[model samples]
Target chain A: MSFVQNFPFFSIILAMFSGIVSSVLSGKKARNLSLAMIVVTTALSAGTLAFCLKTGESYTYMMGHFPAPWGNEIRAGVLEGVTAVLFGVVMFLSVAGGMTHTAEDVEDSKLNLFYIMIDLMLSSLLALVYTNDLFTAYVFVEINTIAGCGLIMIRQKGRSMSAAIRYMIMSQLGSGLFLIGLSLLYDVTGHLLMSPAKESVELLVDSGSYRLPLLVIMAVVSVGLAIKSGLYPFHYWIPDTYGYATPTGSAVLSGLVSKGYIFLLIKIFYRVIGYENLVGAQMINVLYLFGVAGMVMGSVHAIQETDTRRMIAYSSVAQIGYIYMGIGLGTTAGMVAAVFHIFSHSATKALLFISAVGLYEVSGDRKDFVSLRGAAYRNPLAGIGFAIGALSMVGFPMLSGFISKLLFATSAFDSPSKMLPTLFVLAVSTTLNAIYFLRLVITLYSRRREGDKPLPPNPVKKSSRGLKFAIVCFIGLNLVLGMASQPIVQAITDGLAMFE
Target chain B: MDVSLVEHLLLNIEETVSIVLFGIGFTILLLHRNLIKKIMGMNIMDTATYLFLASKGYITGRAVPIVVDGIQDVSAYINPVPSGLVLTGIVVSVSTTALMLALTIRLYERYHSLDLDEILILAKEEEQI
Candidate 1:
């Protein structure tokens, strides 16, 4: 009845309402309005999270007062609260940092539309993370997809056009398969609300009825989301989409979009299907296989990248691998680690993208890795930000990535068979991360003079204050996430307790 | 393997057809190089999913899902849930299809080609240059 519970619905409604309102307004006004909206909503999300944590409360608000089996539901727990806060903060910071690029990268006419899509995307993401109805999840998933494509193609460049087409085709394939899975699920269970569906699913599992069809449904749904999230072999479209978009788009795509899908997968595993049922099904092995392959091969590809942005995009594929690997461990501690990695990765990647934009602008708008050589010297603030981000990504001690890796390692000890391979993959991937990330860091700080032309003064020079503040926030976020890992881990454990 | 169970499944021909449509859609999506055909494949797949959902709402002898005043017996009418879901799916699919076509237009305008392979090759060449 109070702010913590009802605000979830209000957040979504306000986002969509503002999206529509801003789409018709002038560009500058729309930008200011949307910024204000995101900031206030973010503050509210933080407030909600703090309230829930202090009260140790979780709640479910049924739509239209029909209650679960017959009505839509949205459940909020510690996990969802933290997740909403993470999504909000990263989006706010990413957009705020990339404003200069937004003004330049997107055409004037499409700016309002761009802000509209951002609002819609934020709305859909909140719903995706909160909705307890499968059909509601699916609808919001579509909204997020459409909004994501809008963000990519707003540039109207040929490369971005091709990239958008590829992205649409691939993600559509994903949603199509996802839809089919949902249809099969509904067909079998005769219910779409997660709680009822879980009841039916548990009965089926206990009775061992519809075993094969249920397994097939599980596979289809996992595969659909896997493709959407750019896991392993399905990652062909990720780089083109992230690499060619505006810097802000790349940041949002890498940091938030994939994480949203992963969050849904976590929801499906824990809430709808039940964790015990998942172990019985042996479906996590599929995730494990793809995730391992993505880690090794995705990093290898990143090492070969010529474009700086594409390199970071490829690194994302590998980071996604780590999250899936955590899922594959199929333990509560492992899931907490995975979710923690999501938070850490979002902060680090947003930092890197923002820094990369500064580097690119300093290097005369060049996106290629070669041109950015020594460009870091031209922009020291971004340079420092990127260095900190790279070190964290490489899992240096006392950084956010280190905590997640440590959690993953500790979680690995609980599952004997998973221990060795998980450790090996973790070891190898960390080294590979060092290889690519270290090389970039070295190149940034190297003494070699930037060739071909005297680079212009830092392009962010015109409005460096906000960008500088955002980068500093990134640094502080990463450090704080690393050092203050105890309470978050405890919170995650408590939140995950609600799953059972 | 009861003969009656098999017979019941066989009698449900529409779901089978939807499955077949899904197969065709996946095949087109995977094998086709033409971007438009791939988009068409995606639509076909969405249609298959919608049909699958619609069939789930079907009943052997039930009336439509329009509830009249003072109705007491619920089993007299078919399930309306899947129809509502399918309606939403159709709208989402139509909008996505529109966006895909718009992207196709932009692609064709850029590379003067409709084939995905050609676009990739050109993109790679641009990368090298």
Candidate 2:
């Protein structure tokens, strides 16, 4: 094996080891260590992506002496490489952007613990993307859950604490369902490694054996992941969890954490049960219906939300709905669209969250719509950043969101049964997105009313240079994804082809 | 409803019992108002899943998975993978339960209540204040 093939395994272990080491360091040192680790991982993953694209083949690295079905392994293909790169880049930018808020919101003594959680979170996300063993994925899923809870409640406020618990309960329920489904799948297929399991699944399907059990397993696992990803019916924990957490926590949780679960679900659909069998079982239709409902309902909820953070959180539900709807189309083109949307949404959402922090600082730390009037006048960079993010989300031309929407629309034409609803929801959801996000954009730039009482003097001295640099980089990332999406889409298509 | 279905369920009693237990635990988790009760429900659900997994690894008359008396036959012992998996599952559940309990303690200290609804109302009132 080439030395470059070891990058994925190295990245996971490095993040995990750094997490343990960061626990003992002082807060500032831990922050520096964590940032350095993320930067290194991003570089390594970029190298792996380059190697994979050049070689045009996927490779698996055995964890120990045992190989394949006998021992744990991590498989890195074009798709995993691209996902790891995107995750690493977005995670670094989110942490850098939200650093000021993290230091302010979390107590000084417990700051190291926050960085420790970030390291662990990054490790788990990479594992979720690259893991070849089903049981290993489950363990990392739990790790991701616990680390996410830690991130959410690190602010040490009553609201954040309550939100963390609610998130835990919902997350545990999802994992329980996932674990049981995995055990049942093992019982039927007698394999834990994904490739071997897929072989068994294909044989069982072809022979018409264990059909009912297979379908049930597929539904159970899909539902488990859907809940974890905050699908329409199971998103009760999202608003409080996202709104109450620190800015970094909100960005990472909303952008990377949920996407990690959905990516795992997509992997299971293609690698474990096989996509054809997934369609045959009619699970995609269920995902499709829920996706469409979430798209409309989540936006409606957002429209009614007065708090800016909560509105953004609700918009996440809508964005996740679009991804699931893409998957539910059950065509290769649809899958490609879904994967592309994952990248675009991660970049855009993280940008919005971090920029909201800047806007919040300028508005005397109030997050309500009314308090946010003329926020742009106070902080032009944040204002412009939020506007770019909002427009991208609203599918403006030459933005990442517009490209993903176009891909989804074109892909919908391939599936006759889903074509009309996909088009209808796409139209309605975009309009709804505009109603809230555009309004927020307009609110930020509008002058404060003359009749309103004069605001108290702002306590924050000035916005940090790190915050501005992070926002600028995020906007650059969004524009790149928007204006130059052809290469990324090509990469995604190649990765998915190598996936099976 | 069918007679043969009942007979089949009886034949696979361990699986049936575990499924029933899982359902009960899930229902409790969904319906329970108290924080501790919710944690207990999650634990019960986890235990039931372990039972299901353990039963899947058990054979009718196989020895425990060990090299005893130099017996090398594959069928001499039941599968050991699920047992290892169960051990991992137990460790994870213990940690999650500890975390939930820690968060519960924090909530109780802040709100002076263990009931979720009461705590939420108190929290909302606190936010307004």
| Model 1 lDDT tens row, B59-126 | 88998888776576888888988899989998998999899888888778778999998987886677
Q: Could you give candidate 2's per-residue lDDT for residues A379-496 as a string of tens digits?
A: 9999999999999999998889999999999999999988998999999999999999999999999999987655568633467888898899999999999999999999999999
Root-mean-square deviation of Cα positions for candidate 2 versus the true structure, in angstroms: 0.9
Chain B TM-score for candidate 2: 0.96
State the displacement of the C-alpha of residue B48, model 2, in Å, after optimal TM-score superposition.
0.7
Q: Is the docking of candidate 2 incorrect, acceptable, medium or high quality?
A: high
lDDT by residue (B17-97, candidate 2, tens digit) is 998988888777778989999999999999999999999999989999889699989899999999999999999999999
What is the two-chain DockQ of model 1?
0.68
Cα deviation in Å at residue B21, candidate 2?
1.0
For each candidate, report its DockQ versus the true two-chain complex. Answer: 0.68, 0.81
* Deviation (Å) of A344 in candidate 2: 0.6
Highest DockQ: give the candidate number. 2
Give TM-scores for every candidate, taking all chains together and pairing residue i with residue i.
Answer: 0.96, 0.99
Candidate 1 Cα misplacement greater than 4 A, ranges:
A449-463, B1-9, B68-72, B124-129
